[model samples]
Target: MQALTDLPSLQQVAASLTEYWSPRVVAEFDDSYVKVAKVHGSLAWHSHEHEDEVFFVLKGHLRIELAQGAVELPEGALYVVPKGVEHNPVAEQECHIMLIDKKSTLHTGNVTTEKTRSLNEQLRPL
Candidate 1:
């Protein structure tokens, strides 16, 4: 069995993230992948074409803006953006967040702008 102590602390994971709009992979299990990110200001508008993504606020507040509406997620709160839905995430201050999604999921689906990134490119320190 795995022990919780064996897992890295969120603080340690947060330290490894170096850029905005980029998420670093921390762990994976079955069909889901876990990522950590440090965010500030606004992120590019994008969407996942084939997978839903969960955003969990670990430190500060996170705002998710969609075509229908926008939601504010404070620390300890979580929000799930369904597949094929266009959404943009924003942070007023430096915020730490965790994301859960399928292994094949892309951070920004089909939209290959400067903001699009790969999970491998955003690996966090373990």
Candidate 2:
């Protein structure tokens, strides 16, 4: 949650995250939700037809695979996947990332895999 003071620590949240591919909602603004997750392998190939997805690598490395090619991001790197583009997020090693997505955005887009988490799950008490 963003505030004028008593700010939340992303580092603290990232350090406490234990589940891979399960994103936890950390904050929100306007129509967007801020999420953090610890990802180690890969998420399903999917696309959000109506909303773009932003991924900010908080730790380790991340590879966003697109049909054209894969974009690699080291720690502190950010990438925005345009709407209607298919993509799969992968991390060779354990990685922490913050995702900025629309409030209605689904983590798996149109495909649901074992790792897919519903919005309610992400919003649960931490």
Candidate 3:
């Protein structure tokens, strides 16, 4: 994993971002990755077969649209999308988020979209 944060301030890193829906790797912990992203609009509907994805709202708001229900997260809130659950993340305006995902997790799970990000691309220096 790559990051500018030796003494990483999540807010500062989030503020430095210039891309939408692009998540940058910030650190690695055991079998999981710590990533940050600025997002707007909707990501494709997808599901991770076995990996649980955790999202922490750093700024703005987020809604995790699930088949059964949608989870709303305001800044400082967090939500976890359990394994095998189909979900889509949506933000009406710009939002910053921190995510914790397993090493084997794919950005868009089983679905590939224009917004999908590869692990190598995410691992690039932050």
Candidate 4:
């Protein structure tokens, strides 16, 4: 696992993806879990009431849509969505991103949908 491994390559982990929207845990540091996901299309609008989510674009482009506005993130860009803010992520094309969030964070806040994934699913080996 990542705890015993040395500096993992995000690219390699991202390249191992076989589907969209599914995130794989890569490491854990303190209260946060580092993950990577290949995304396309849009994720349901949701919010984490008690945790902020950190998103870093690794490739392609991503857009974080909030109730009042939206931010477009290109490769090498990063953004942090504060807790309790309703937002959705959309990628017009396949995009790879790294997410840093608490271990207790849910897949999609209070709303469960077809895209929602359990923590066990996220922790699967890449």
Candidate 5:
């Protein structure tokens, strides 16, 4: 029988991305997908009704804005936005982030905007 392979490096996969706000699926764990994104500027505010979204900062800084407050995440920091909470992610400069969420989770959650990317798009080879 053949064995499964290890995932590619997050640093290497992130470096290959030339687009902002678009995430690429790099790995899968349990019922979730591990995604990497090169982000700058801000993403539209949205909420996942049934799934919590986990964000890990790999490089630079990231800020997640909620209606009540905002949280800042520096490199190596991580945060989890609970389900049903509205939030937006912003990066003043180029930042690399890893996201872990359910496989059925949508890029923009309940709101669809131009920044919304489909699973098919994210599944493209790095």
Candidate 6:
């Protein structure tokens, strides 16, 4: 079994991330997955068909745009986007965020925006 001390710091892990719109898996469990992503500008407008996605702001603010209205999630705030709800995520500047979702969930649901990315991909330090 691995020890907690063997794990890398979030800052250390964040430093190795080079690409935008791609998330690096940090941890996983039977029911959920955790990923760290660096986001800038805007993301695709999409919704999960079967599961809700939780976004936790780790470094900067994030704007979640919904059909009804938009909500700003500042650092340390957690927002959950319910399933089947259309929404978009936008970041004015570079921001680090942690996402929690179900094991079978996709990064983007039915929407085929430019930011759509594959799921469960491992991101190693370069």
Residue 116, candidate 3: C-alpha displacement in angstroms: 0.8
lDDT of 4: 0.93
Q: State the weakest 10-residue window (summed lDDT) of model 6.
A: 117-126
The parts of candidate 4 lying over 4 Å away from their true place are 1-8
- Global CA lDDT computed for model 1: 0.85
- Model 5 deviation from native, Cα RMSD in Å: 2.4
* Residue lDDT tens for model 4, 52-121: 9999999999999999999999999999999999999999999999999999899888799999989999
RMSD of each: 2.3, 2.2, 2.8, 2.4, 2.4, 2.1
Give lDDT: candidate 2, residue 44.
Answer: 87
Candidate 2, clashing residue pairs? none
Q: What clash count does candidate 3 reach?
A: 0
Q: TM-score for each prediction?
A: 0.87, 0.93, 0.93, 0.93, 0.93, 0.88
Local distance difference test, each candidate? 0.85, 0.92, 0.93, 0.93, 0.94, 0.83
Worst 10-residue lDDT window for candidate 4 reads: 1-10
TM-score of 4: 0.93
Task: Evaluate residue 34 in candidate 6 and report its C-alpha lDDT on the 0 to 100 scale.
Answer: 83
List, residue by residue over 1-126, the lDDT tens digit for candidate 1: 889888778766876667877888888899888888888988778888889999999989999999999999999999999999999899999999999989989877757778777776866454
Candidate 3 local lDDT, 28-111, one digit each (tens): 999999999999999989999999999999999999999999999999999999999999999998999999999999999999
Candidate 4 lDDT for residue 40: 95
Clashes of each: 0, 0, 0, 0, 0, 0
Which candidate number has the best lDDT?
Answer: 5
| Pairs of residues at least 3 apart in sequence or in different chains that clash in candidate 1 | none
